[model samples]
Target: MADGKFMTAAEAVALIRDGDTVGLMGGGGGLMEATHLFEAVQARFLATRAPRNLTVVHALGIGDKKTKGMSCFAHEGLVKRVIGGHWVWSPAMQQLALENRIEAYILPGGVSSQLMREIGAGRPGLISHVGLGTVCDPRHGGGRMNEAAKDDLAEVLTLDGREWLRYKPFPIHVALVRASAADEDGNISFEHEAANLDAPSLALAARNSGGRVIVQVAERLPRGALKAREVRIPSAWVDAIVVDPAQRTSYDIPFDPAFSGELTGTARAQSEAADHARELAAAQEAFGERQAVARRAAVELFNTGKARPVINYGVGVPDAVAKLIAARNEQHRIYQTIEHGTYGGTLMDGVLFGYARNATAMLDAATQFDFYGGGGLDVAFLGFGELDEEGSVNVSRLGGVTVGPGGFIDIAQNARKVVFCGTLAAKGVKLATGDGRLRVLQQGAVRKLVKRVDQITFSGPQGVVRGQQVLYLTERASFRLTPEGVELFEIAPGVDLQRDVLDQMDFMPRLAAEIGVMDAMYFTAALAAH
Candidate 1:
């Protein structure tokens, strides 16, 4: 404490005590991930096994879905419990949960992020309707993933004769956050990162609980290098800083200052644009039927007469929707947003899903979720791995793998309208598109539309109760979510309704009085343009 807050990752991690509740701050694609700090903790645990049975909390899917980030803490005795906002990126942890090796509880992204802020403010708990009728709801398993999870972390209460869900807050013993730079005084700034994410709230939560805040920074600066407004985490809230000088901007790229919007001069913008174009071109090479699904989803948005619609996109095919929108020169007509707080920019996909190719402005991750939880999104395009007769969607789990809903629940539930985009089936499904018509080369072995989804990430029945217009857009067909169930609304040409649609589904959907054919133009690569 006397020499300065700067320390090596191992030295900083030594402060974490056994049985401590550690709060982690990071989003998808390794954005603002304290990799060195996490690695140091893992190394220390393996060597000494001192900090055993620690409860870990994360607000998003961090890591590369393999051996990185929180996966380091997936050892049996190191982690006793996990309260996660998303689990898709951590397969090792999910495997532990499946084996009942650790207690696992999952909550919506907005709720978890807000819970940290409430904890910082010394609030009793977080009260919100973000997870009212979903798995996080007490009536629906209370967000528990396996039998080992037993605590009732959330409860349903009545206020003013209305129901609200309150998530109980726990004491934080350590907070690990990542930033772009930090002064020797431990003043943090995320000037070069894509988003600030949960760093601010995590630090505050640790400070309020009399815990230590360990930050990972790409660069260690002099005390006065950080401007007043740029200090995202104050020195008062920070306990130590670990500097990784060679830190890359994300998992894929080494460093791109244009992402931070700080070096967005004309020359830099042009260079970034060229690189973005090459990436887009490569992604489009494998578009295949994904193009049809994305175009159909985007057409629904383009048809809407609303001027400059406020739209948000999830990863996967939804990213294609953003590409189609930009290709059509309709980017200016809609205010595009990503859950990581980037707004009005070309949306990026893959490991860099939460970032933007070019952004107009960036806000705090919690503030972005506030807009989503408060019903600020007019339309949200999201990917679906599974959908059932009841219109429930499951992108969180499949075949023993748990990819938790990063921000899917918050965006899907709060948006005025929701479009679930994906293929009708997966795993070797083949189709050919030509002359504005599709030919079914082969049907997929896995039927995405089933009697019941393996897990309910987006509760369609809940969306119906909220009076939201929900649509499932697939390559071969489309369905509109009704209060009773899903109703078949459209089908692709050159496909048999019974063989390709009805027979493949586990449960029958209510057919529209006159089933409309999907626009023929959607069946070709031209859909991306015209």
Candidate 2:
């Protein structure tokens, strides 16, 4: 080791004691993930059976959907409990939670990130309206995933005749965080990382609780080599440092200068063009249902004639909306923001959902949530798994699976205009699009529009109370949220209102005064043109 604070991954992980609460900092796709550190912990536990019955907490989904990130802690005896913002990325951890082998709780990603900051500052707990009336509320299972999660981590409190959800704080015994590099004196910097997630907050939470902060870095630099502004976590906060030269920017990507804002000028434009070409190709292949929905949603960006509107694109069909905007050369007309805090760039999808190529700026995840919670977004396009007659949308728990609402609640509840994009139904649904019309070849067995959702990830009634303009866009139909309920406003060219839209839904939505047909250009390759 170069110094007392510098050590191998094994040595750093050895400092973690049994039954301790470990806080991990990473988002999906292994952004800022300390893979070697997590692997060392898993290896040590398997060999010695030590560090048993640990409690793990993470603000975002951290994994490659296989054996990395939270999966390394999936061993039954290794982890006794898990409190996370999202769970779908790590199927192994989800399995553990599903089988009731571990106590599992899911909170909103923004709430989770801010709660860590509260804990670090020695606050009582996080008291906010972020999760009110949702699963995170004490009245609605209190963010508990399974029967094994019996403890009440959230409570409903009334102040000044207003209801708010209070998320209780807990001590963190160990913080496993990652950054791009660390100085010889143990100051951490995230110069090469895509996002500076909740790493600094987690480190502070552990250190203030009389615990340890172990950081994994790609390389080690001499003291003072890093600029003052580059040092995200000061040396006084970091206890141990583990250098992993092979650390990747993300799960599948080794290193990309575009992701870290290192590319600029013509280089940035060329990189973006290449990425757009590949995304355009992929979008063309899957251009039937989702593409139509995205095209309609993209049109909303120009609604109300708002110039340079700030927008957020959630995963799934909503991500396609950004690509459509780029394809039209209209990206500069809108400011794009991701939950992970990257702004204004070509957003990546799949495992790289939180990152962007040629990002304009990167804010810490907690601060980004602060902006979102304050209604900084002019519009937000999100994906939905279920839409109820009451206009509520469910994306968290679907088909007997627990896919926690990552940042859906925070963004949906605050954005001035919320547009949800998804297929009318899922599982075996097929469509054919040509000649400026769409034909549904097969109906899906699953009806996404239901009488009631499995969970209330977005409360339609609450949105109405806040006076938010909400719209639901699907392949064959479009609906707007009214004071009464969902009202159908548009249908596809080749679709029948009764058979294709109404009959497929579980309940009847209010009919618009005058229903219109969606633009035909959206159904063909002409959608790429302005």
Candidate 3:
């Protein structure tokens, strides 16, 4: 961090070698913006004769197979492989990768973070009480990049007495991270930056692995300037530092006013709650339709005709779904119910849960995983994406590549019957049946469902084996994954089978049930595609 040692973003990046695994920092547009630094390094590597086998890692995004903004490495065919927990990878990244340009792998957020923790601890890998007997199971190799990834995941071994999911160890050589501020002594302070994203954990892991740790900061100071109490990252672990003084200008985050052109909100996520208050009000108009579907799905899931009703739920539709069950006096169809508690529900909360709602109880993250891993959760409802002829849904990766598995594998595995509540092929696409009564179009077309998913957020294999009926609720049609391709169940009124459904998709699906018309109240909101 000495003054004279400073170099341009391009100069510092030249230090990286080919095939080196670099740990990057910063998740969304925040204080730790590593994009510019990476771009500079990538450009240096690409403009000259460089090694193609480069590995990049980060808490949130390594931009997967494609890189954008400042990613000369991702663009010029310099990077060979990439990995991350969340997929916010650049969409064009995977296409080039699939074309043999780079190799990519996506892991669950929590699991991936934990993997880095295990590395820092010097353990080969950590055993998890999460994502077992589900899509992320090592048996399927955790949906690794390719043959090599399969081998990396193949090392996991489940303990017989107590069930848990385990993954192999990954070594680290270099790390690229960002910081809000740092002092000459190396005491770092996030100053509420911890909540920004997962940079701290990635940096710790990189340092513990004996790898060279390079950090990008907004400023540097004299020897005792920053207080020890304010330091987030200690100087002992820091190897090199690069400073970018301005807030968003020196490193612009497009979505943030602090960084970028006129455009904002990469996914409309930052300040989404405040910015889209009007949208939420509109979504409220369709509350009746959502509530009705929730009630029906809940009743069906509750009345199993056998066991005591113990239910578990997820966010979004499941929150509304649980409300229906509660309306029925916790019906005989249900006894004790649980939810991830993301919505403002006064229900029992579990561990690792964000608890956006005022739930009855909340516990440690570890305890939540215990219930999830123990296979005690009953029925659940959630969201999803495209299901191929093989029934593989690519809900994980998208064009912007902000794909994820977030606690999905854990919930799906424990639930008896999982209800995936989402519209199918949204974009004014519609279908009709039943003497022409109901009419509707698809809404919320997620971009992840391509010919193949960049990552598997949910596993169709487990759904089929568990007798799980996947319901894709669209205003126009309801599609379910069968042993064959996804089968269309019913269609809305004013919609045609031949014109709307079949025409949009690149592939054909099994026609299971004759399309039926939905109710009248469902047509107010026109379904739009992402």
Candidate 4:
């Protein structure tokens, strides 16, 4: 059962040469990350200063914000360029981009994953409508994050008389992927992983490009130990296998059968209960403004009137909708999904946002995005960093940081109904809610409702043209997107419309002909009743 394909993490990383375009496979919070390989590369570079000026490509953000995942390549000369779906996980990398040290570019997570397959197939590139009007569009900066990023990775072209964005492909000289186990012949299985991200595509891209595909696994099994059906990457495509017995399912979690879809039914329920208890204890003030916004957004799930609607919730306040739905015992009435491909489970928050506890099913990231791009989602609730007078939203490239839109563009552009959840003002906003009324204790200095957004992540005008339902939900008010712009139709109880709602915005929104007061239940502990 022995072969030269098996090696230590350092030996596997040593195969990477200088100036190679290395592809990494993982999602947020180090899910499925080849941690040992990344550590080896970082250590090797620090010790020998080899593999300098490399180009790093990742379909999703992979890090814990402090020091892991992409942050390992934060050194000035370690990486010359970066192309990723999201960037907030590694602040050090973001600083490199901010300082114009590295050529940084962002693309939608779905586009990046699918583009990998296109590269593997030796196709021209990915030509899709996923980012026709967003920042990825060539006309809209072409996904460049800084002046150092000079090349246009995306281009706008008309296909069949319809506009589409073509995300150019690049050769992946080295692909670093992770799985639960690898057989003696190098076949890989992700049986213990929470989600199978773009690992297969990355491996294929590397192999088809005549490059090396290095995979890190927790354990190594004898030949034929893994079933043919369980092997995600065939031995023929993998070049090196690194065994790290200490590999974890996620950064914060050592191991959880529910995350791998091995445990379900009553066991799953108990796991979800434990997670809810932990989150509730950690966020006792969750009943404040953010929860109120989530409460209103949750109502939209039922308003769709579908017997069982398929929905997605973005990170931040939008995640609260899942908790509210669980509180109402309405989990069975809707199918909740995450962009990273888990469905029907208690969605995790913070660094664990991509994985779900007790998920009923886990699809690979690309297949899930296919459903989303085809308008399979009945509704998608997303958090917004800025809302403009034209009803456009800006979640990417905000606050002087280049946090790319992971799946926000793919979900928002394709969902039948999109609800944006956030506070009217962001920094230092304080609110008190009780007895069916909300009081703004202190206003935030930053106004999220602006006349113009710094960048457009979701084009409201394009959404209106597509006839999609778009609504903005906040603690103080709710607005519906219209051809004329944002129309304020609902106001929170005990809030002065002019002082609390209008004054907080950089631009005035058109008032509805018959504005209504938000239901009092949203402001109180009886939110589940509604």
Candidate 5:
């Protein structure tokens, strides 16, 4: 490459070759903005198949769909495999893989970053205790390599009662990065870009792997002032720079990916615009004719004197639920905690760094588990992939691959009331619940809430032992899991009794005396509009 001319994002990405494993710079907290670079990767991937058998490591998201970035990456099947914390908000990639549209693997975000570091630093693999005893647990196969992916997942092993995962060394051919500012000499500054989880380590990884490192900077500042204090990635690690002055011109740092999406994408922005209308309608419907009955039922469900204010939210409805709880003036009493450095925002490696709000207490994951182990959580609102007759919830294992247990067990074991939220059945299964009835509009060969789950994300035996309350909330009805199984409770107003609720499941439980209806707010405001 000659020195005189600047490279456009499109031109710079032309350097990528097939069979190359690229180490990207963005790791969520806006470390260096990866959009320009990620877009370039997409452009290159879509134009031709030259860069097949590629590997990716960096802040991860699909960009379109319910999750950000899916519109580009997941839509194009560009993600053969993904190794990061999660794209919880963007489940489309996982969906595609589950349906065999593409290949995918879910890994611990921190571990993914570590593995890249190992590869870049010319090391063999990474060792950690994070995924032990969970799906990441090697006993279940440490992790799977996607069909189109080039590298194998690291394996887990135990030495002297201590467990670790072994990821062999791999070569990196390219590194895509985002930076705050840079000088002519190639020194990079992430100045305020602290939100990127592990960008600093990634730069070294690319350089260590003998790969070219490309930086996408928001602005170009004079080279001299980017002293050691400001310099995050030195010029030695950088190969090219794509300066885009039209963007906001500031590194996103490490704001929560959810917040970042709130700022960047269109679907999220549309939802934001509809927030007021949704809220107004939700309030109106909630306060409508059946509202009192619903409220009383909702209250009685949690009227147990043992209930606490601590709140645990699954990834799907977390943003809305947390905001609802907070806006309801309950953040103070309700303990809002996520399984990370901060709470109240979605966490996906490289996507979100931390929530904008102040986390009252920040506990190391282990200590946080201590709270979970003791059954300290008052209620948990989470998403579910499927449930069986035994009332077992599956959120961990999806598709044919695995996304090891993150903090699901800890939360499930400790939370008093665990609420699973999502559409009742997806894909080929069309479902509606009403009048204690289950109706199948388009019969699926499979039911998401099954007689038994393939692998247990949350244990029914454990829930029984703790005598905690559990609820599975869907669009049409709610299933309350008692010791005997799930008892049919509230039904959507227009829903039928036998067709919508009862007939759909494999098992039948004794009806509970009372079950509260979901608030109309989420349906009208969040769901209908979003």
Candidate 6:
């Protein structure tokens, strides 16, 4: 207890030195972030211009798309390099990566989380097939984001006559993490947080490497109050603790005992207490087009005929598919899983995506990715920002923004059947659907179907090489990928082939002699009946 010291954020941040590699912890919208610590570091840099040119590492995106989390360190000379698993939440950081002002590297979320553990255990590096044929593969680009990213962090080698990637490790000089409570001994507990994330692993990596572990927590308790089993990071691994009494569980949720499993109640009580009806109504109102796409995709899922199919849905438009499944009361028929280790239960939309309403069980994030990376999902419904003539899908970078692939590469590369979902275009696009027909009210200015994508997050050519089934679903038409290219399989009724479909695309698609119309039921009364 005496060895662990309570310190202010400024004092804790002062431990960082210039050119050091600092490890961070957090994810999008789940504000389990060390906000106070980030502010202190930012203030220190602004006031004294010290601790410049440091390398930052994180396994997840840690901001609110504003100046809240990692954006605090977005100034020049503060961060020289960044190695992250995701990048959508932090716009400033992404801009830096886009402009080549800083070196950027994006890796799979599972690999980055697991890499910390390997470093803690004194391993040479991580060896796995998680990023075999994607951009993360050394043969491709080794997870580089821009011209500034040139270091060979990954290497390709054969294992058991099969290709595998080895992601090299680097020394961690400091770790910045968040927790719910800390005892006098500096034992941390995340009893009011959503997920434990990588706090324990990050601490071990920092402490073992003779680095400092700085933790920000909500409250401080006596030594005997926190049980040994409840302590995620022991006093031995923790060096300093910073208390932010006003810390909230997330942006909207200040405190929810249920999130940390500290509260228990009847399932009926939990269900009755939820505002699912309100949330569902709002989602339906705001996601009409997405709901239509989901209805069609649901039919596709139903037709797959796989018994108890295990399905994974990505965020955004594909999320409507999960909502549709729940509305149909078909959750039991399909095993819904996510990369966050949540299996079965209602998948929440928006900022609360990583958590489930009534999760059956929760596994470590890294463990869940291992399942996905090894092709455990029967089907995956993912959103795409761009679809190319070669059938490659891009969701990572678009329109000069660097939104790294969080889990798209792993899920898309390994899923048995992938159904890419999104609108034919974005921004101001309008559509009308009713009575077994669909009509375009107005076309969007930005077309999603392009000649070539800015970046290839899901390689359609690779999927074809592996004999995987790939389908592209839109509000108007659907296409299937083959060895030759994209082939038009179905079109919506009341839509012109040349004006609404062909004219919007950059390249011509192979068409069958008899192009079929999408089942009218998808556009009309079938959705209402469900």
Tell me each candidate's TM-score.
Answer: 0.96, 0.97, 0.63, 0.97, 0.62, 0.92
Better of 2 and 6 by lDDT: 2
lDDT of each: 0.84, 0.88, 0.52, 0.88, 0.55, 0.81
Residue lDDT tens for model 4, 1-530: 32579988888899999999999988878799999999999999999999899999988888999899999989988899999889999999999999999999988999988898999999999988888777888788788989999988888888788887888988999999999998888889989999998888889899999999999999999988999999998999999998999899888778989889888679876887886665555444446777778778887998887999999999889988877776555788988898888898777788888888778888888889999998899999999999999899998889878999998999999999999998899788888886799888888999999999898899988898899999999999999999999999999999999889999999999999999999898888644334
Candidate 2's residue-wise lDDT over 1-530, tens digit each?
A: 43689999888999999999999978888888899999999999999997899999988888988889899999999999999888888999988888899998888999988988899999998998898878788787788888899987789999999988889999999999999999888888999989888887889899998899999999999988999988999999989999999999887789999999999789988998897777666655645666777778988998845778899999999988887777666778888899888898888888888888889999988999999998788999999999998899998888767789988999999899999999898889888995689988888999999999999899898889889999999989999999999999999999988888899999999999899999998888655434
Q: Could you tell me how far off, in angstroms, the CA of residue 276 lies in candidate 5 after the best superposition? A: 11
Better of 3 and 4 by lDDT: 4
Model 6, residue 255: displacement in angstroms?
A: 1.1
- Global Cα RMSD, each model: 1.8, 1.5, 9.1, 1.9, 8.1, 2.6
Q: Per-residue lDDT tens digits of candidate 5, residues 266-292?
A: 855454445434443553332221222
Per candidate, the number of residue pairs that clash is 2, 0, 25, 0, 43, 0
Candidate 5: what lDDT? 0.55
Quote the lDDT for 327 in model 2.
Answer: 68
Better of 3 and 5 by TM-score: 3
Candidate 6 global lDDT: 0.81
lDDT of 6 by residue, 441-503 (tens): 898899899998887788878889878889999989999999998999889888898899999
Off by over 4 Å in 6: 1-3, 261-263, 283-287, 303-306, 525-529
Q: Residue 177 lDDT in model 1?
A: 89
Measured with C-alpha atoms, the lDDT of residue 258 in candidate 3 is 15
Q: Write the per-residue lDDT of candidate 1 for residues 1-530, one digit (tens) a residue.
A: 33578888888999999999999977767788888888899999999986899999988888888988779888999999998888877889999999999998887877778889999999988998887777777787688878999977789999998888999998899999888999877799988987778788888999999999998899989879989998998999999888898777887788876677665678666855675565456545644777888878987786556777789998888888887776655677888988878887666677777877658889877888999888788999999888998899987667856567778888998999999998888888888885577778888898888888877888988888899989999888899999889999899987889988888788999999999998887876644455
Error of 4 at 448 (Å): 0.6
**Comparing 1 and 4 on lDDT, the stronger one:** 4
